[model samples]
Target: MIQYFRFLIISLLFVSCTDETATAEFAKGADVSWLPQMEATGYEFKDEEGNKADVLQLLKDRGMNSVRLRVFVNPSSDPRSGHCSQEETVDLALRAKEMGMDVMINFHYSDSWADPGKQHKPEAWEDLSFKELKEKVYEHTFEVVSAVKAGGVTPKWVQVGNEIPGGMLWPEGSTDNWDQLGQLLNAGYEATKAVDDNIQVIIHVDEGDNNEKFVHFYDNASEQQVKYDIIGLSYYPYWVEKDYTETIDNLAFNLKDMVKRYDKDVMIVEVGGLYDQVENTKNLLEATIKAVRDVPDNRGLGVMYWEPQGEKSWSGYSLSAWQEDGTPSPALDAFKN
Candidate 1:
């Protein structure tokens, strides 16, 4: 009985710490999952003084208090499109934590990019039966999560699957089959909690400005008994080819609506603007951060820039916040406040 009471006290303390973190920190950072690969290729990051610097430290100095890292199964070596294996992600998470930054682990459940457009299962998972698929989901999630903790950093949040509004693991776990999707999601959720109930689970989707998308997905997820602690979103104005001014209002409204309707904290887990439009991007980020901070009860968790350190020259991706000269763009200063 004494041991049981002692355990209960520790458990409650852990839960309390998790809640305090959500209310205390407004997560502001980038999904710099490609940092390891970029550094391996000899790309250097510079501070404002043009002196070589560690990008993580530069981001922290700019007011970022968190980092989001994505994990893949057996991945390819492509710097832009592949190689976020568990080991790589765990290492990155350790680095971020060592720098006093909170970490979010994103499970893509695929060997490549998994988004609203496509969610291909990893090659090893493709042929499994539905039952086997769910087990794999749990197993994979558990392993990576346990590994991250063992590496000395417990991720504050774990996204069950990336941009999964249409569902993940393909036909068996697609939106067309919400029941199956829910089960698969719960498998990931359960796995996450099995590692540590203190870790919050996130369900991510794209098109943050589209309220209909949120309603359609979350409504169905609710009916299907999908369990989650947070709603994660990806908002990229450059991808939509529109100036952020056009949809910033909608995004703000959606943020409030999701919190009220679902009673869950919400986060702009991924967002970015064109590297060339630094001023406009800065404005967009400032507005985005304000919108989140304005949410009642602070249910609006935070906003994270996707790949802000990914230089366009090296990534061939134009939406990063890094300048061509290898310095971080002023746009990142939005987090300065």
Candidate 2:
């Protein structure tokens, strides 16, 4: 009887330790880059029960512990695209910080969207030479990070460029020119560390399920010795048309392998679901969260829903978690886990 009791006690202690370790590690987050703009246009968000609530507070109540905001350098003259300028980004970051949520600042490095297909340099930087543009990247990163710190909110993470699968700063720093791209990335990384050494730097790219793409991008970045802490991926189900089960399994496998290969943490820094497909979207979120959480040795940091509050009329963005009435979709419940 004493031997059996000892075994039981050992099992109980193991379970307790496992629970505590799991609790200490995961983060639930959302990218609400359009929050300020949506609120500016009189959009209101309500809790699941229909009570009017502050969006940030509602998110916190729903178990989201982090928020990601994107910043553009000298945004376009158009009002819609101009609101995410450095000052506005700092203001938003302050708001998120006030709510006791960690903040991640995504630098697009352009006056507009900077993705794989379009990484247009800010108009101001268009005139600079290749060498000069590298300086600009460093200067921009340091300035924005400095401003965020000045606003009394030191971001927990900083993304050097948004979805740079092909690369950023156009032909000058495109993937075709891996050497220049590496220099620009290193510049951003160094600048971010200059402001705050503790801030985790991320290199974001789209197509989370494409393992080869990730391997290719990181292999080049590694070869060029680009410094970064996290591998951020944008995984949209609509973009990856494989069988649902296959897709999730592939993503999970890649996530684990990437962590082992890079020896760095990983995050689904950006993801979105169709507004009308609440149930399906919920499944996707649950699967994605699980995949990230399943990375061995706690290397899976978290997943962030991209623009969960963006409604059709607000920004014409289709992949929001908000219904037409401004109430959060059932898809958001996945974050509650």
Best of the candidates, lDDT: 1
For residues 163-189, could you state the per-residue lDDT of candidate 1 as single tens digits?
Answer: 988899898999998999999999999
Q: What shift in Å separates residue 148 of candidate 2 from its native position after superposition? A: 0.7
Q: Give per-residue CA lDDT, model 2, range 11-118, as digits (tens).
A: 999999999977654778999888887787788888767777889887777779999998888876454576698988899999999999999999999998888889
User: What C-alpha lDDT, on a 0 to 100 scale, does residue 245 get in candidate 1?
Assistant: 94
Worst 10 residues of 1 by lDDT: 21-30
TM-score of each: 0.93, 0.91
Model 1, clash count? 0
Structure candidate 2, residue pairs in collision: none
Candidate 1, superposed: residue stretches over 4 Å from native: 1-23
